[model samples]
Target: MPFRSPYPDVEIPDVTLYDLLFTSLTEEDLERPLTIDGSSGAETSYAELRDQVNAIAGALAARGVGQGDVVALHSPNSPAFVATFHGILRAGGTATTVGAMATGKEIATQLEDSGARLLMTVSPLLDAVREAAALVGLADDKIIVLDGADAFESLTDLIAENRPAPEVSVDPSTDLAVLPYSSGTTGRPKGVMLTHRNLVANVAQAAELLGVRRDDNLLAVLPFYHIYGMTVLLNLAILKRASLVTMPRFDLPEFLRIIQDRRCNFVFIAPPIAVALAKHPLVDEFDLSVVSSVFSGGAPLDGEVGGAVARRLGCSVRQGYGMTEMSPVSQLIPAGRDDIPLASVGVTVPNMECMLQDPATREEIPVPESGVSAPGELCCKGPNVMPGYLNNPEATSLTIDDDGWLHTGDIGTVSAEGVVTLIDRLKELIKYKGYQVAPAELESTLLTHELIADAAVIAGYDTEGEEVPKAFVVLQEGAQLTEQEVMDFVAARVAPYKKVRQVVMIEAIPKSASGKILRKELRGA
Candidate 1:
């Protein structure tokens, strides 16, 4: 068990999305010095930030956005994203934040699917939002910009007037707080409906599991559009009262400089960022003495670089696993648990249930009660589980089974100690000569070898007949490893069916903003 609430649960007040705003404003927070928003062109005290949140939340209520209404936000990491997100949730409407770098097609697809009635965006990306609005038959006026003549100027004005946040009774168990989207395993993006209870429970789980504290300066670079960033960095940070260092885009020089300048104590990272930090030579410029730990999530990290970065920084480096469906957190490695970065994504967090089941049958597989399950589809259940999908009942039925379990599409295993190790993606598994092969397993093996900077594994077919595993590799600069040498390196490790029949040396791996390798895009290539 973790540290108990200093105050009784009933007396402490049930945490809601907007409750933070009010508490931050009315309560004394001399402990938190101030916040520097890198994405926004200004500075703010925690007290001032609370007032802005109240203004925006009240402004949203004035516009008649109420319970169950869909409010979308499309912008980079900025103060607007926070205010708009809090405003939408506090007003009782579901908040959906789309990836800032999403293409017109991806944006339109998610927009039409979510049935969002209103959008908040920056001036730079207005056209794309407009295109998405048109796809869903929404009017141009529904597309609200942050700056210029077409800006949605209502909420900012309300903040200036200091209006009370709209009066509304909210239940943690029932009210919708956020509607983050996830692909689950296949098909297009569908909105995962998360209630206020789901979010609060997750906050408690993360705070206890990760040992988040108020003094930790955090680099919150993960996109708010994704659940991992929104929950772990934004909400969890608020609960712990950590100072968030938000950066809109990823430029290595700038990202590194932010750490050095701000003296960030925590970093929420994805696989690509982990790889970059491990391989980049300029990383030595910064003093990371205060960076107590770095948390990697959303995607799996290479054991090689994970170990390298841990040793290089002389700091705690850990990984987490989750999807939007499970209120976004399934497992996380505890800080300073051990020397080896567990190939597993730590263990399932407190209060959440995770298991491995036969992928085809959906029956639970027997394994150690705690650690990682046997290699199979991973499934979870908890209060944090989403109620259902938005405007898509059929899709919801498919993701969450009749038993109320959120079936994660990834193939994984759990050890006796409850450590969850993900070996493959269910959809990405290749059947070579009727034997099953996990692409990620091969990729991890290849990446663990020295001289290989990054690797991607995908299935391809030969002209004669069979599907085969192919590898795309980016070798470290000045390393003289040949294709044959790389293939031989893998040949020593596993079964014949898993061998890389073909190899392609590439300069980079194609990835999404969330840092997941675009296997579909790789197939097209």
Candidate 2:
């Protein structure tokens, strides 16, 4: 039996995300601050933001950016970045956000895959963005730098053009709004096609589940490029008309200072940040009395860590679970609900159904009677679930079944009250400090080395309790190579987060008859 959401279903507005977010704001509310720059302390009012979004949308239209066109945005969290993202949506175009830290090749791959017609970035990332733009065949004019970089069209120029925003009608349910890449069940990165309705539905669903106070201010330290921040901080904060303090990067001192200065009431974070808040010595130095709750996602939050943070801060500490494909939020701890299980990821949000099924038998698993919960593969069905993956129907079909159920590829258990606790991930991808690192991608890269006969990658924890990708390599007979050499080779090619931190020389890699790596056996070894 599917465990439905305990909360009653909320209404999802049938409109563009921009329309859904702005429709409720009054003229008086426009002058109110919507976002604040954590570094500079600059504020962008709702009215100012809306005007900028309109102007940029007009400029995009003049540049022939029609509906369904993809515009790739590569920048850290900033007020300008926020405007550009919504401007693309305002122009009826899809925004494909790339991580600011991504390498030129990495950005180029996403550019090519998403078929982005334009690239918007900051000057700091210009060198890498330029290389990616060139590799992806994006013309110089099509690449707009946020801060004026010599000769290239700047965001200032676009806003100056001030053409009319294009009027493109869209099917709310089917039209793609944001195309953020996610490594789903299988590890290769693919675009998750989120429709306007999907975003609106999730915002509405979360609004019903979370306790979002109008007076609460949010601390936005998470990267906006990631779905968690994009939805929770950027979109949802705007939906609730909450003031958001944006941080470009996470620094412990700076993070605490902002909380002190801004009196930030709600903090959305990953497990790593939660760990820092729990154990960091500087936490006691700051005045964090105003903070109401700390919410952790992206990775599992240990019960001990959650409890410690709560004890230290004298505030609610909670965890939630979702992937990029689920508009990034399926379950979250309620705003003021202190009674929810410490380690549990909370109940499914409104209008969603979740289930636990035996992986091998494909049978529905019941809640365990032994006090301890029985773990099974977690699956879900909801309006918030993605329509499908972009340009990858095979993966879409595999992930979402004919019955509209999304197989989460995670091992978890649900209580009779609908609370969820994740046990382990069944996917072969490694979670290195909250970033997805595919073992298959690394294995393929390892095979390119002439000295390597075979390779397999698995995740393991270091001394600090952070997940690290550990690679096992079978070298060619008598071929000389050190473990450092293996790690360095992959480090130079891949992103910093995806680099292989540990390597073990192995005689041979165990595999199934069909040539699938037996990762479980290697993990055991």
- The estimated TM-scores of all candidates read 0.91, 0.82
Best by TM-score: 1
lDDT string, candidate 2, 1-525, tens digits: 787787888888899899988768898779889899988789999998888898999999888898999999999988898889999999999999998777899899999999999999999999999889888788899989988899888888988887767788977899999999873224667999999999888888887466766667899888788888888878988888888899888888999999999889888877556656766668999999988888887766667667878888888887778888899788988876777897788988998888888887988887654454577889998888898888899999999988888998888888767788776666665888888776756775676676776678899789998889999998866789999999999998888998999999989776421123567678766
lDDT per model, in order? Answer: 0.75, 0.83
| Candidate 2: residue pairs that collide | none
The superposed Cα distance between candidate 1 and the true structure at residue 394, in angstroms, equals 2.1
Estimate the lDDT of model 2: 0.83
lDDT tens digits by residue: candidate 1, 393-502: 89888888887777778888767656667887888888898899888889988887768888999998899767899898988888878888889999899888789888
RMSD of 1: 3.6
Specify the poorest-scoring 10-residue window by lDDT in model 1: 1-10
**lDDT for position 129 in model 2:** 90
